[model samples]
Target: MQLDTIKSPGGSGSEELVPSRYAVRVGDIEVLVVSDGVLPLPTQMLGHNADPAVRSAWLKEMFLPQKAFDWALNAVLVRSGDKTILIDAGLGSDPDLHLPRAGQLINRLQATGIDLTSVTDVVLTHMHMDHVGGLLVEGVKDRLRPDLQIHVAAAEVKFWEAPDFSHTAMPPGFPDALRAAAKQFTKVYHNHLRQFDEEHEVAPGVVVRRTGGHTPGHSVVRVASGGEALTFAGDAVFAVGFEQPDWYNGFEHDPEEAARVRIRLLRELAGTGEMLVATHLPFPSVGHVAVDGDHFRWVPVFWDY
Candidate 1:
């Protein structure tokens, strides 16, 4: 409940939280990449069989650790003139995910000099726990929900915020933990969510693109400016899965749709060369998807901020 100072295993500084910054101008608009925290994951869970995969050779070639994975929870801040928007809230106070850093969006938000209340909107790509977890301030309520309009895909509304989701779902392999991870998504923020249709505009310079499958209402945001574009691909594709974008996550409510969406998104990314940002990609989750023979590769857009 206190400001956690989970140092990035090897970061040097007294700053408990260090953010990855991506500064780009979109037709005169400024966009910044703010991250919540990184999840120290095991690489094998991300590989074809959780590490030591075929690329295990390449990882060794680069002299990187083969032991595990550290995924970043990225939240983008778009500031055009005086309008400010957050792409997705981070994992807030979820104990089970062991996500002390996972929900640091609020702090990252502060680091970016943006106030949560003044945030014109909090655009959610899906209802996944990590993505929607930071919707609320850790232990505060009225202080956090008053002025924000949460934008979620309509289908996402019926799914996560619906009774069926809580009812039909089985006892999560780990309930209390999963629930802790998911509870941050509980509030409706005014009991009114701005659900959108396909190709909706989240804000000026921010366009919503439907790329469902991961979550029924899963969507991505296309931000274009100064002849440059970035797509907050959301969870349409994950780390290891991006290598095999065709494979769906274990919990896709609709596996077939997830696969279809994966292929379609990969095709678009490959064709247009738009940068992809994943909420759950390897830390700093920004990358370019390129065609490699019969598969796709994630060329991580590395950063130093």
Candidate 2:
């Protein structure tokens, strides 16, 4: 059967065969998960600390490629009361990285009818390129409101000043690229930052709390209202995290602490049964956590058309 196609509203003349955005409602707050495309990275990055044999076995069990696979990149748009909050800007554009497909957040947002100026605030989970690069995209800053507030953890802002990569196990060029992006982002937008100590509410029922594992200032945002809740877990959790909570993702600045943070967050979500959405999970990455023996389980919610 031939696939149907929709023209992107961004007027790039590009066509998408599948939807790139999904919306979920938590009480009165509106959350829209937008796909920023995908990043195909080496499988070793999944768990640099894991035994290669074990990691390969798990990959084979999941029917994924042994070498590398696409990791979904997601960013969220939220509307609470009169405030419009953006969570993570997505990888904007880095031709040197040769990741042509991963920086589509800006175009995708435009296609969704979301104006940059309309975004009253941007809540960053961390300063990773994928999380803040979109704002650095040419014309992005100019399009945003001059008074726009960018909320991020004070610790996170401080860490990038002299970031360390001693514990991380990433691809050769990653460290330098990450440093350059973080530094450039801070330099360009320092005046707009609204640094918080630990937790800050960007809007009613929308709170960002630092978790301090993925990075010294990494954070997660929770949207809670009317007894319903959902958390955008940033880099704290990944698809493999539920099954291998102790494994260390290469992108984590503090792999050991990142593992602990993942375990703690997973356990908490499993107990609370709140919905979970993450940056690297599959598109629409809206799911619930379930306890599975000694580990945990990912229970993706049924698609709500």
Candidate 3:
């Protein structure tokens, strides 16, 4: 395949298949952006800021009524040649998060005509269950099948698999069920795979680059073919501050390191004018980053269908 980009559907922030199903293609690669679901955030999740009343009013002005912030989880699926690579699973919403859409990743996969049995690789950007929630099904507690090469950063694996990790101390932002589900896969994933290097190749041109910061060993997957490239940025730069291009992620283990990597990543993306795919960049989250004056601005490219 020379190179092809197909737009699917339903993604609000990216470009893909349809208004309901999200998918895009570049040359021999077919990347599907599927939504786990959406959530509403309160001022606390926004960050410790100014007056609550003032902020709440400001949020209302911005159309964020009900004093909530809404977010969506879009998992990426890259199919090239005979391999199917899943990048981060949607948040395991279920009873853990008291939400129901978290486990729709597999459903979305099947809807895209990609079979879970054929997915040879399950790549994790970090230890956050939302990013790796779909590795196992909702009810198949012990009947897990479809052998896979689960790739993770050694540091991330160690962090999640750490025996001393306080499960009860998991951030309130994440669902409790998600944490429990993660524990289940601890032994299983350890038996199958471990951490990856700074630059590890998964598929032909698909490479996992160490852009650690969000987590100690967090990484971003870069897909390049026929001179066309796209990066799957997981939680590095959320939408609000990403437009600023300089604001540090509140959740990053090391904000300074995260900012530095974001700068380098943006500079590279802008230089190449390659497509950028992000987990939190909005639906159909495919776009380009450009240097604007002294700052960088993310440009969402629309598919002309």
| Best prediction by lDDT | 2
lDDT (tens digit, per residue) of candidate 3 on 1-305 = 11133323235444443353456767668777777766555534443333556556645664765455556677787887767787887765445456563466765655444556666787888767667666656553233444667787777766554432331223474544444656766765667674676778988988887777667678888887776778898877666544444444445556666677777888888898998877766777789888888778789888645
The ten-residue window of minimal lDDT in model 1 covers 1-10
Clashes of each: 7, 0, 30
Per-residue lDDT over 1-305 for candidate 1, one digit per residue giving the tens place of the 0 to 100 score: 01122123232332554445455445665666667777665444343323346557645755656866567678787765556777887777655445565677776655545556667777888776667767655553444546566777777766654323321122244334434444445554536478877768767778876666766688988888777788887777776565566543444556567767877888788888977877777556667889888788888765534
TM-score per candidate, chains pooled:
0.78, 0.96, 0.81
Q: Rate the local accuracy (lDDT) of all candidates.
A: 0.64, 0.92, 0.66
Q: Where is model 2 poorest over a 10-residue stretch in terms of lDDT?
A: 1-10
Candidate maximizing TM-score: 2
Q: For each candidate, C-alpha RMSD in Å?
A: 5.7, 3.7, 5.0
lDDT computed for candidate 3: 0.66
| Pairs of colliding residues, candidate 1 | 26-225, 27-226, 41-69, 43-68, 44-50, 44-51, 91-103
